[model samples]
Target: MKMEPIEINEITGYWTFLRNIDWRDPWLIGLIFFHIFTTTTALLTRNRINFQVILFLTLLSMAYFSEPINEYAALNWKIFSKQQYFDSNGLFISTVFSMPILLNCMLLIGAWLYNSTQMMAQLKSAQMKQRSRKEAGIATEAKKTQ
Candidate 1:
């Protein structure tokens, strides 16, 4: 007996692929929480290396070693009956998986830098206002004594 390959529609294939993702995975949940924590802390507190390193490692693990990637690749093959694209076609499966992780890493760093700059600007503005107030107070006292 011979079996024929089933052709997959783009929308249905993607929907099935998304459904196959294991949302219940504890590590993935933890990673989600970690991202939230890192983003909030970076925005609220002084920038630090430890948090950045942890975020990088978590993202790296998700991109490279997680079960979701392999599952997606297998599902792609099963649905399409062909090898997943790796630069052959305009669409690359692995790129789609990794781009978000890379973009988020850039965003984390950008957020930290932006927050730090804003804090510094506020500090400088406060210092200038305080200095101006002190000088004005001293001038008033001198005029009264004269």
Candidate 2:
């Protein structure tokens, strides 16, 4: 039997290609949960460098490795034969995977900066309460002195 060179669309149907937008795809949506799970794991284990490193590495490896494997299987098996996806074509999915991890890292570093905005409000309320307490304590102090 002779072989045929695969044109991109031969691998994926054009109609299948047009069907879903980024967030609507099943895998991309599944990735949202993956991101949240991985992000939560990364956040909860702050004391151990090894755990954080391992989790981050796991996320990286999944992005770099698991995604390609998934795509290959889908294409080869004709699971997604209706749509063609190259690693490059999947820029959207790749972005989706990266967003949560990137945001988690940034949130840790930026949360304190954000907290500063509220710091003055918190301190002023606390100070006002303390001032009222001190003003009201004059009678109690006189009784103690007596």
Backbone clash count for every predicted candidate, in the order shown? 0, 0
By TM-score, who's the top model here? 1
The residue pairs found clashing in candidate 1 are none
Cα TM-score per model: 0.44, 0.43
User: lDDT for model 1, on a 0 to 1 scale?
Assistant: 0.58
Q: Which tens-of-lDDT digit does each residue in 58-78 have in candidate 1?
A: 877776653455566555654
Model 2, residue 6: distance off in Å is 19
**TM accuracy, model 1:** 0.44
